[model samples]
Target: MRINVNQTQCGFVMKNGCYEKMIFAGTYHYPACMGYKVIIEEMRGRVGFKEVPLKVLKEDAAFMSRVTMVEVPEGQLGILYINHAASAVVTDREAAYWNVWEPCELRFIDMREPVMDRNVEKNLLRLIAQQYYKKIEILPGEMGLLYQDNILTDELGPGTYYYWLYARDVLCRIVDLKMKELEISGQEILTADRVGIRLNLTATYRIADPKRLVETIKGVENQLYTRIQLIVREYVGRYRLDEILEQKEAISGFLAQRMREEQEQYCVEVQTIGIKDIILPGEIRDIMNTVLIAEKRAQANVITRREEVASTRSLLNTAKLMDENKTLYKLKELECLERICTQVGNISVAGSGTLIQQLRELMGT
Candidate 1:
């Protein structure tokens, strides 16, 4: 007598009368039937059966009887009978079989963990069906569906899945979503310490060109960030330290625009590129400040010189006007005399008569 154990076909197998008796007595000691007996007689009363003969029963009878039996062992068993009908059974007395029999279908994309709901398994199955059979069926989950192509099915088949498994999502990023970092140094550019400019630049980018981005960068997300940083460094290199510091807005705008153009091939969107800090060498910054101060001082001197020249010209014009008019001189003498009299309380005008006579002569009296 021969007994075969197969999980796919059935749970357990029973060979002959002797083997059956041995199994029933727990001599076989299989994990599925450890405490139970394999004999028909032992399981008969418990499983609600009268008698099971090897000849009268089909090959599946033993499996069906074992499934109905209350006590068995810990594993899946395939029960074979000579004349009983064929059947399969799980002797494990738990609900673990629920998932085993009804498995969930899932696809992982871009390292993102898929969220599952009550209908995840069902939806996943429906997705699989739609991809292969072109059947439109709604599944659970808030994720939007873009389009289905044979590409996905050709890759992953139907199977049970756990976390962190690799699979593709619906909308493939032209580039990967990642942060890129880069470091650069140049002789012409100012450096914080001495060797190079210490700039902390952060750029956020997503894959815009899936095919090209992947081909060029290997990892589109990280690669794009690095590329943008490189571009920024290059742009900075084109200008002097002062230019970069003074024209930050120009630098930022140029960086954003150039990055967009350069990465267009990858279809990547440069969400943001920030220059966290620009580190200038201490010596260089000090020199720049000194130069600025000197320039301002020079401008002040020019303004002062201009004001002096204007004042001198006004004084010359007043002197020239006084020289051109003798009558004006006579009036000035009288005015001086009156002012002196007011201060001294009395001034006998020996000059006043001569001044009045001169003034009358000048007036053609």
Candidate 2:
């Protein structure tokens, strides 16, 4: 049998349907004698190869080359072929005939879903634009991490980047750089005065360095959340219930300051930290209400006593003015007589047979 491999093609040597070795472009002859039955055929054609690229093996950060042929030794080299890690292997005749080429253990990642563009691009625009070749869009509020052969090569910012598609196993990971808000609700905390309170806090943060944020901090959101919660608990524990009640803003400020200082090490920028609510226990709330009512009643009593004192002083002054002034006293008596006459009805006066004369006698006139 005679076999040939061209410059644009690669061949695989198989014995009774089992892979033996890979062959580059060349001519070979195998005698159709003995048990040396060898079969060589092209692995793939140009069309399918282009669609599923046979990229170059990654070596270093600056080295990337797309070769027409590559050798797969006996379990020495591996590759990310067609979105999955695979290794070429030669199986026995029976296994190969039964199609028993399987992939090894694979580490899968949760890749980002592609966001399709909504606008319709004209044919000419699409052809002339990078869409025809390769287009990777790092959307607004997102950061991209570029990886070559599962090793981080660079971090890309929000924008469009084009790379050689068939040159290497290239992947772009999108990390959201927008402000993240975390709310820890109903956290029971103890105060310095031995009061137990339920606290709720809202913390907003954004990624400062995407690379460091991923490399240094595992579970970035959860880390920030736990840090904030601890700071709140510690700071609140140092203050009494009354102090905390009166200084909620100060507590938030303290928490923000502490988080700002520590979060830098984790590549996070804490934006706004706020205490959403400071919930007192049911019994504490009742007691506080009772205290408040007692304070208000005391204040009201003081005000009432002050008014009474003022009224008594005013009455004493009026009485003294009437006693010192005779004409004023007689006018006051006449005013009293006028009031009495208006109030009383059907009155009879004896002696002088006049109500005014009887009233004057009654008053010792």
TM-score of 2: 0.56
Give candidate 2's error at residue 187 in angstroms.
Answer: 1.4
After superposition, the stretches of candidate 2 with alpha carbons farther than 4 Å from their true spots are 1-135, 148-164, 330-355, 358-365
| CA lDDT scores, all candidates in order | 0.45, 0.63
Provide the clashing-pair count of each candidate structure: 31, 0
Residue lDDT tens for model 1, 8-98: 2222233442234222222233444443323333222123232454333334444444433223333222232212322223233421111
Residue lDDT tens for model 2, 136-239? 68988898988866789887877876553333467777888898889988888999989999999999888888887666667878777777888888788999
Off by over 4 Å in 1: 1-195, 200-221, 238-261, 269-278, 327-365
Worst 10 residues of 1 by lDDT: 95-104
The 10-residue segment of model 2 with minimum total lDDT is 91-100
Q: How many backbone clashes does candidate 2 have?
A: 0
Question: What are the per-model C-alpha RMSD values against the true structure?
Answer: 14.5, 15.1
